[model samples]
Target: MLKRIWTIFIRDLTVNMREFMTLYMIIIPLVLAVGINFLSPSINDTSVNLALIENENPEQAAYFDDFANVELFSDEQKVEDRVMSRDSVAGILPKDNGYYIMTQGNEPESVLEYAKLLNVLYEADVQLEDARSEIIEFGRTVPPLKKMLVNMLLLLISMLAGMLIAMNILEEKVDQTVSAINVTPTSRSAFILGKSLTGMAVALFSSIACLLITGFYNVNLGQAALVVFSSTILSLLIGFIQGLNSDDVMEAAGSVKLMFLPMAGSIAGYEFVTGNWQIFFYWSPFYWAYKANDMILSKSGTWPQLILFIGIILAICGAVYALLAPRIARKLQ
Candidate 1:
C-alpha cells in the first residue's frame, strides 16, 4: 500500500513539475518572501529621512545619520530633488555658514520637526552620549508589521496547498485516470494519501522557505511546523471536494480560491477587533491559526497554547471532514 501510494505521489509530482501553473505556484511564495523582507522596516529603523549635501556638510551629515535615514547627495540640487520625491524626505542645504531646511511642503509635521531637531542638536555641538539616555528592553526583537506579513503569507501558502491538490486531482479527472484507480490495484485510501503528499510537501517547504528568507531563523520551527501542518487539514478537504466536483481547471481553481474570503475576515477580526467582538472570529480555524502563528513569531508561544490552537484547528477540520465525507465518497464512486 505504501509503495502504491509512493508511485502515485511520484507520478503526480512529475506531472505537476512539467506544468507551468504548478511550477508558478511553487515559486511565487519565495518571491513574495524576498519582497516582504526588503519592504519591511527593521524595529530600530527611524521613520525620519534626511537628504543632505554630503560634500558641503560631511560632519553634519554623519551626525544626522545616527538619528535618521540620511541620503547623501554631492550637490544641493540633488538634495532638493530627493526631498521633492514621493517619500517624505527633508533636505538640509548649506548657505553662508548656516543651514536651511527644504521640504516639499507636504511632509509630515513630525518628519520636518525631527529634521529641525537634528540640525539644532548638531549646531549646538551636542553629541549622542552627552544626552544621557537609557534604553529599556521589553525583549521583542521582531517588528510587528513584518511578522504580520509573514503570517499572512504562511496562511495564503497553506491555502495554496489545497489548490495544488485540487489541480492534481483535476488533472487525473481530465486525463480519465481517476476512473482507473480502482482497477489498478490502488485502494481508495492509497489514492487519497498519494494525492495529499504533494500538497503537504509544498505547504511545508514554502512555509519554511518564507520563514528563512524573511530572517525568522530564531523562530521555533517545531511549533511553526505543527501549526502549518494542522492548518492544512481544512484546505486539503476543500481541495479534494473542488477537484472531484469541478469539471475543468478554471472551475476547480476558482472554487478553491473562495476559501480566501473567510481567511481575510478571520485575520482582520483578529488584528482589528477587540474585547467582546473577538468572539465572532472564534469559529474560523484561520483565526486560531493566526493566533498561533503570531505567538510563535513573537517567541512567546507556550506549548499548552500551541496544543490548544492545534486541537481547535484539527477539531474544526475533523468536523468539516465528517460533514463532507459522505459527499466525497459518493463523488469518488
Candidate 2:
C-alpha cells in the first residue's frame, strides 16, 4: 500500500514539475516569505510626523522631537490646519500651565501615541530637563511581527496546497486519466489519499522552507509543522471541491481567487477584530487553523488546544470529503 501510494505521489509530483505554472506555484511561498522578511523592519517600525505650533519654549519643541519629527508651524492656525488636513497625525499647542493635544479621530495607533505623549507631557514640569528624564519611559513597542509573518506563511501554504491539488486533480480529469485510474486496481480511497498526500508533502516542504528562510530562530518547529499540516487539509479539501467543479485550469484559477475572499474574512476576523463580531467568522474552517497557528507561534498554545484545533479541522475536512467524494467518484465513472 505504501509503495503504491509512493508511486502515485512521485508520478504526480514529477508530472506537476513539467508544468511551468505548477512549478512556480510550488516556490511561491518561499519567494513571498523572503520578500516579507526583507520588508519586516519597515513593517514593524512606527514613526509619525508631527506638527507643533512654534512656541517660545525650545524645551517643549525638543521634548516632542524625541518621539517624532517635530515640525514647527508659524502659528496655531497653521498647526490646526495641518492636523485637520491630515498632513500629520496630531499637533501640539502649548497653553498656560499645560498643553492642548490636537488630534483627528483617525488612526488608532496615532491615538495611542498621542495618549502616551499626553502622559509624558502631563507628568513633566514643562521643563526640558524634567521632560528628558521622563522620556526614558517611552520606548518603541514592536507589534506582533512573528505572528503576522506566520500568518502569511500559513496563508500561502494553504493556498499553495489548495490550488495545486485542485489543479492537479482537475488536470487529471481533463486528461481523462481518472477513467483509466478508476478501472485499475487503485481503490477510490487510495486515489484520494495519494492526491492528498501529494498536497501535504508540497505544503509541508514549502512551509518549512519559508520558516527557515525567514529566520525560524524563535519558532517551535514541531508545532509549526503540525499547524501547517492541519491547515493543508482544509486547503486540500477546498482544492478537491474546486477541482471537481472545474472543467479546466482557467476556470479553477478564476474560482480559486474568489476563495480568497472568505480567506480574507478568516484573517481579518481572527486578527483585526474582537468581541461578538469574531464569532461570525468561526464558521470558516481556515480560521481555526489561523487561530492555532497564531497561538502556536506565540508559544502559548497547549497540547489540548492544538488537539482541539486539529479536531475541528479534521471534522470539517471529513464532512467536506463525505459530501464531495461520492459526487467526485461518480464523475470518473
Candidate 3:
C-alpha cells in the first residue's frame, strides 16, 4: 500500500512539473512576495514628501525636522493642489492637529505609515504649545512591523498553498490523469492524500525559493514547514472538492477561487487590519492558519498551543476531506 501510494504521489508530482503552466503557478506568488518586498524600499528609508498649511499660531517652519521635504502652503487650496498633483504624501491642515492624506490608493501600508508620522508631528506641535516635555508616542501604537511582515508571509503562504494545490488538481482533470489514477488501487482518500502531498511539496519548494532569494534566515523552519504542510493539505482538499463540479481546469480554478473568496479577504487584512475582528475571522481558515504559523515563527506559543492549532487544522481539513470524499467518489463514478 505504501509503495502504491508513493507511486501515485510520484506520478502526480512528475506530471505537475512537466506542465508548462505549473511553472507559472508555482513561481508567480514567490515573485509577488519577493517583488513586493524588494521593490518597495523600507518605510524607514522612504521619504515622506509633506506640505504644511501654516496655521495662525504656527511658528515659522522650525518644528518639522525629522521628515523629508516638508513644504509650506499658505492655504487649504494650495495644499489640495499640491496633493492633487502628486507633489506630497501628506498635508498639515489650517487647523491645529489636522492632517490631510493625499490619496488612499496604492500601497495602503505606505499611506498608513505616512499618516502616523504626520500624527506624531501634530502631537508634538500640540505639546510644544502647552509647554509640556512629553515625548510623542506614535508608530509604536500602530501595528508593529514584525506583525505586518508575519501577516504578509502568512498571506503569501496561504495563497501559495491554495493556488498550487487547487490548480494542479484541475490540471490533472484537464489532462485526464485524475480519471486514469482512479483505475488504480487508490482509494479516494488515498488518492487525495497523494495529490495533497504533492501540493505540499510544491509549497515547501516555493518557501525554500523564498528563503534562498530573500535570505530570510530567521524563519523557524520546523514550524513554518508544519504550517505550509497543513495549509497544502487543506488546499488539496479544496481542490479535490471543487474538481467534482468542474469538467476542465479553468472551471476548477474558478470554483476554487470562489470557494476561497472569504479566505482571500481575510488574507488581505487579517492581523494588521482585522486582528480584533474576531467575528470576521470565524469563517476564515487562513486566519487560524496564520495565527498558528505566527506563533511557530515568533516562538510565542506553548507546545500545546502549537499542537492544538495543528490538530485543529488537521481536524478541519479531515472533516472537510471526509465530507467531500464521498461526493468526489460519486462524481467520478
Compute the lDDT for candidate 2.
Answer: 0.76
The better-scoring model by lDDT among 2 and 3 is: 2
Alpha-carbon lDDT, every model: 0.90, 0.76, 0.63
Better of 1 and 2 by TM-score: 1
Clashes of each: 0, 0, 0
**Model 1: which residue pairs collide?**
none
- lDDT, model 3, position 93: 62
- What is the Cα-based lDDT of residue 90 in candidate 3? 62
Per-residue lDDT over 60-98 for candidate 2, one digit per residue giving the tens place of the 0 to 100 score: 677667757778899888887787873346776777876
Model 2 stretches astray by more than 4 angstroms: 42-142
lDDT of 1 by residue, 254-319 (tens): 999999999999999999998689999888999999999999999997999999999999999999
TM-score of 1: 0.91
Rank by TM-score, descending?
Answer: 1, 2, 3
Model 2 lowest lDDT segment of ten: 134-143
Q: Is candidate 1 or candidate 3 better by lDDT?
A: 1
Tens-digit per-residue lDDT, 1-333, candidate 3: 667667767886676667766666776757765764655444354576666676633552445534356777788788767766633356556454454455424435765576566566666655445555666756432124544554455546555565556666666666777678778777766776666666677778776566445434465677767777776677766766676567776776677677466665655555557546665665566766777766654556776887777777788778877887788777655
What is the alpha-carbon lDDT of model 3 when measured against the actual structure?
Answer: 0.63
